[model samples]
Target: MTHKRKIFAGMSAIAAASLVLTGCGGGGGGDVDADGNVVIELAQWWEPELPDGALRGLMDQFEEQNPGIKVELLSGPYASTREQLVTGAASGTMPDVVGLDGAWVNDFAKQGAIADLSALMTEHDYDDSQLASQVEVDGSTYMVPAVNFVYPLYTNDALLADAGVDAPPSNRTEFADAARAITEAGDAAGTAMPLSLETPSGVQNQVMSWLWASGGSMLKDGKPDLTNDGVTETIEYFDDLYQDGVFAPGAFTMKEQDMVEEFTNGRVGMMVDSLAHLTMIRESNPDLKFSISALPAEDGYDGKRGIPYASWGLGVSESSDHKEEAWKLFEFLMSEDANAELASMAKAFPGNVASVPDFVEDDELMSQAFDIYQAGYPANEFTGLPVAE
Candidate 1:
């Protein structure tokens, strides 16, 4: 902090200063601006619906708080964010500050692209439990969460009533009963799970939640252990679900988006989905009675019930010359106000826990996520599993 501040000297006391703005118009750039401010290019896949200038507002506030630093946003759709990040690192054109998907954290670290944030975590007092587990590998940390995703179970109350399930299922045995009962009542499939290796990641998400809730894990000997008892039981149980028509036969080929479509169309009685759809649920089914809950666990499993977590994190590039400034921007972005603003629009878990209580739209999901932010394992059991595999 001491040495980095000397890198920029201002024009006296600044007579009504003007902030410089370079949007995501073209490529990335991390240079000294004409105004003597350090330009830090920030690349993220912030949704377009976030008040149009939510990120811009953050940048403006950061500039106002700390003079002589300008953050340029290189925003794009989520579909291309990962590709853009990978290509940028490969071509030596990466932004000074970039947002990455939770899954990319380990890969980026292996490629030597992102700086380790261990020291920063210590300096900033960031608890590992409060942060997403995906950003940390071995004994080092690579990224700090930008926004974390909160996944919750969505249950159709009408279907449950029709099936005579007065309360939500808390364990796998009851879960099966509920699924079968709902399906047998002629409403639709009992539950919708994305099981298709067509999108391998989606398969991991679908399976891992069930496994974790059953107190199983992916890494038995530092690799995916498909032979784990819980994993095997989950596979068998899901097979039963498919065979009994509790889950659609196409569950083996359905993607996450497909689940979303079917659930929204009132074809599924229960499903696990992101908090992002809080608004979409009301829009899709105005009369549907639904409730949210944590995923079910095994009847006799004594271990903790874990859920899937997806994170978007902020990290400085490994080769960047502005590590200190980059860390500053990272801190600013993760501040409570900034975190809440982004989370309010993103409809996901906020990076800062202080912002959790303010959320009310999907309060159960947000509150649950906040309480257990330091909890849960990955949705993917294995690493580097290609889609075709």
Candidate 2:
């Protein structure tokens, strides 16, 4: 069966199961309490299991601050979360609050699954500038940025030194020279440039980063620009990298986990991956001297120092019966203290600007990550091709 067909089949099963449960519970009773407390359910895909009472603790604090409010957390797999959410919205069983990746927020807002928060922003004194740029779509915000994930270039400092390199390369020419030197010395298999053809999406994302760094954009004034010289140069650069034997053999078949292991195990000199790899790399190799840097740019391009930023955020459903209560919870979660707490619990980056102060003295990885965040550009998730309507 096709991918879309399988997704539809899985959603049908979920809807059937939800209906069975609803029938057993006597079907669609009131969602509020006797004391007029507005109960709101929050659907998220952060983990397969509910967030071990950490979110509940936050909810308890929210309830204490607002006496007539309650929040429930429901968790599921990320792959199925969006489908289930859309299904629920169609069936009028949508949760009051929902957690979504930023890319999905635009489509959801356009479809009216999420309520517009422009008015709420004014009433709550919320500023769009406080959140990351990626979460904002065409001037109106659909969701509040909750956590951010950044992709950085991971380099083994010791390997570079052994290969007679004193420091990491800040641009493409020096990077290629270093990679070739490492490969010749037999200390490493050069650089494992991420170009997995098996997963075209991954290849496309990497290409866009290079294109942007080369001072090119997928769109110019809302029109496609695939025929530009910068785009061609970006593609040719990767093709040359492959032809020069810099990339690992059979890289087209290499999955993300394989790439991570290759670099961590000292087989590869450098790899580009998420910030989450820092903890694992440090634990697995205490003696491993590595540094994280923003992805390199073309030699003379003005936009050369850019990295792709990915993240998730929180939103309220349009069909929600308890929007006011839901917004209260949302506001509480975005507060500096709560954001810091959530960042600690999730081992993820904070989404609020004020939380930066709290995180400055927390840990080295977070400190490095925050630096990258300040220097990086918004990630390009829509840099290639047009989606068929």
Candidate 3:
């Protein structure tokens, strides 16, 4: 797909100067230092999840290869990053390079907040075929997924055993029953539900996942279809759980991190969570026993299940003055070796079609998650929608 990048590239020097003067910190000044080095900002939520300084080490490697370019990492939690990036986009002061969520792609592209990646690819003669599916807006690419993380049901083995549940739930009925059993047996809630409307990703990552588990969708022919039978039933099912007091307390204000924390502390019996959090949970509570499984499906459907996923999507900002240098960092991260290393560190799958995460072969839990991913189709309807966040 061909699209013009002139609109982004043609931003005037005066406007660039204004953005530099008023922008938030973290390499917000896209300028060459006195030492003749170009400093480009890399903003995202990935670094905190990585081994301390691991992502920085990778950037050091990139700096070595590209002598005149330097990268400044601006890392934070997802919610904070989203807020900062949104404000930057609004004021024409976004960082040089950003880690994107597919959900934010369409809105950013529509507002001319991110560069047209399709044009960049064509200009650089990059091989798009090696990458997994991308996020496009209005027929032009804007974001490249660097790695993929799937959400799976994480059950506290000890809690389940204590509750007298024999196995992980494989269907809706069994899941609900197990959750209730856990609740009745002890102080722990049956499931951790993060429904914070402030962050709102709970809707995308948790609630929508239930419908997907049963091969359902919120979109019909690329439009809102929330009134469908699948959605109606999914809502009712969750409502019943709510009435039964099986959902964790503070769900209305809980975030994904809170959900993971609850599961890690044995406060919840089960949750559907990102595989990327495996390292954190293990590091936080070494003795907590848990098992990963595909989310419970609607009973006896027997078709290929729909797996929910999110990506560490990469993009260059339209407001960046160091676009060329930003593109270099983006390219390095997407390279096969780099992509594989990142996926392994995150306990996720590589976005490069030819890259494979090495951890899956050694980690039993990761192996199980990979198998679940293989058996199901990736199902996320918000990937390229406006106001999806």
Most TM-score-accurate candidate: 2
Across 66-142, the per-residue lDDT of candidate 1 in tens digits comes to: 79888877777764566567665654456778887666777777777787788776777766454434355665767
Model 3 lDDT at residue 177: 100
C-alpha lDDT of all candidate models, in order = 0.69, 0.68, 0.86
Per-residue lDDT of model 2, residues 103-132, tens digit only: 577677766778777767777787756655
Candidate 1's C-alpha lDDT?
0.69
Looking at model 3, the pairs that clash are none
lDDT of 3: 0.86
From the highest TM-score down, the ranking of the candidates is 2, 1, 3
Worst 10 residues of 1 by lDDT: 12-21
Each candidate structure's TM-score, on Cα atoms with residue i matched to residue i, is 0.83, 0.85, 0.77
In Å, residue 23's CA in model 2 sits off its true spot by: 12
For model 2, name the residue pairs that clash. none
Can you rank all candidates by lDDT, best first?
A: 3, 1, 2
